[model samples]
Target: MKKRLIVGISGASGAPIAVELLKALRDTGIESHLIISHGGACTIRQETSLSVEEVQALADKVYAQVDIGAGPASGTWESLGMAIVPCSMKTVAGIWSGYSDNLMLRAADVTLKERKKLVLVARETPMSPIHLRNLQELSMMGAVIMPPVISYYHHPQSPEDITRHLVGKILDQFQIDLPQFCRWEGEPHV
Candidate 1:
C-alpha cells in the first residue's frame, strides 16, 4: 500500500514550511491527506503567493476543517502518521485538551489515541507560562512539539534553506527522507 500521511496546516506564521513539506512529500510519492484550519487558510493568503486552492492542490486529498466524518477523523484510517505544521497556540491548546471541534483537532486526537506519530510544529515567540504548560501537557500526551527554531549550525543561506531543514526534520519523524534536508554530520565546519 502507498504510504499515507495526514498533514494539518494551522494558523501560524510559518506558512512557507507547510508549502515546502507538501512539495517534498509530493516529490517523494507520498499520498498526503491535508487538513487546513480557517486561520491556516488566512495565513496562507497573507504569507504566500499561492492561493488556498493552490495549497490544497498540493495534497492528494483535502478535507474541510468541519468535516468530522472525514477519513482522518477515525482511528481505522490507515495512515503513517499526522502533522500540524506551524501549529498555532489555539490549535495546540485544542490538541492538548482533546478538543475535537474541527477535523484537524479530531484527526490529531485520533492520531494520539491510536498511538501514531503526531508532530506539532508550534510557532510562537517568547512562550508564556501558559504556552509552556500547554506544550508540556502535549509532550506528556505523546505529541512531539517542534517549535521550528533555526539550527544555525547548518549555515543556512536563505529562507528556503531554513524552511527545508525544518520540513525535512518533520518528515524525518515519519521516516520520510528528502535530499534537500541538511543533515548535520557532526561539528560545524567552514
Candidate 2:
C-alpha cells in the first residue's frame, strides 16, 4: 500500500494551517485521507478563500464527517497515523471521553486503539483546567497534544510563513521533514 496518513480538521482559528499541511502532504506524495468536521467546513469558509471542496481536493481521499463507516474508521486501514490539525476543544473532549460520534473522532479512536501516532494540533489559548485536564489525559493515553505555537527564531514574515512553520512542526511529529521548515541549529553565534 502507498504511504498514507489521515488528516482531520476541526473547527478552530488555524484553518489555514490545515490547508497548508494538506498541500505539503500532497507535495510529499503521501496519500492523505481527510475528514473535516462541520465546524471545520465553516472555518474554512470564513478564514480562507478556498471552499471546503477545494481543500478536500488536496487530499487523495475525503470522507464525510457523518460517515462513521469510512475507511479511516477501521483500524485495519493502514496509515502512518492521524493528525487532527487545528483540533477544537470540543473534538479534544470527544476523543478524550472516547466518544466516537463521527468519522473524525472514530478515526482518532482507532488510531489510539491501533497504537498508531495520533497528533492533535490543539488550537486554544488560556486553556482552562477542563481543557488542560483533557489534554493531559489524552497525552497519558498516548496521543500527542501539539499546539499551534509560533516560533520567533524562524523570523516568520507573514501569516502564511507562520502557518507553514507550524505545519512543518506538525509534520515533524510524523517524521516527515518539511523542506521549508527552518530547524533550530542552536543559538546564533555572536
Candidate 3:
C-alpha cells in the first residue's frame, strides 16, 4: 500500500521548504494529505509564484485549516505519519500544548498521542527560551523537532539547491528513500 503522509504548512517564512517537500513527495508517488494554515497561505503568496490553488493542487489530498474532523485528525486514520514543514512557532506551541483548534494542530496532536512520527520543521530564528522549552517538551513527547537548517557541506549554490537539501533530510527522517543532494563520506571531498 502507498504510504500516506500528512503535510502541514504554517505561517513560517520558509514556505518554499514546504513546497519543495510536497514536490519531492509527489515525485516519489507518495500520497500526501496537506493542511495549510491561514498564515501559511499568505507566506506562499509572498514567497512563490504559485497561487494558493496551485500549491494545494500539488497534494494528493487537501484539508481545510479549521476542519478538525478530517481523517488525519484521528489515530485510527492509518497514515504513515505527519510532517509540518515550515512549522511556525504558534503552531509548534499549539501542538506542544495539545491545542487542537485547527486541523494542522489536531493532526500533529493525534500523531504524538498515537506514538506516530510527527516531524516538525520549525522555521524560526532568534528563538526565545519559551520556544526552546516548547521544542524540548515536544521532543520529550516523541515529536521530531526538525529545524530547516541547511548543511554547508553540500556546497549549495542557490536557493532551490538549499531547499532540496533540507527536504531530502526531512525525507530521511521518514525513511523515505530519495536521491541524495550531497553525499558525505566523513572525509574531505577528493
Maximum-lDDT candidate: 2
lDDT (0-100) at residue 131 of candidate 1? Answer: 88
In candidate 2, clashing pairs total: 0
TM-score of 3: 0.96
Worst 10 contiguous positions by lDDT, candidate 2: 1-10
Give lDDT per model, in order.
Answer: 0.92, 0.93, 0.91
Q: Clashing residue pairs in candidate 1, if any? A: none
Q: Residue 49 lDDT in model 1?
A: 93
Backbone clash total for model 1 is 0
| Candidate 2 per-residue lDDT over residues 114-154, each given as its tens digit | 99999999988889999999999999999999999988898
Q: Clash pairs of candidate 3? A: none
Model 1 per-residue lDDT tens digits across residues 42-108: 9999999999999999999999998999999999999988999989999988988888999999999
lDDT of 3 by residue, 30-109 (tens): 89999999999999999999998999999999999888898998889988899998899999999889989999999999
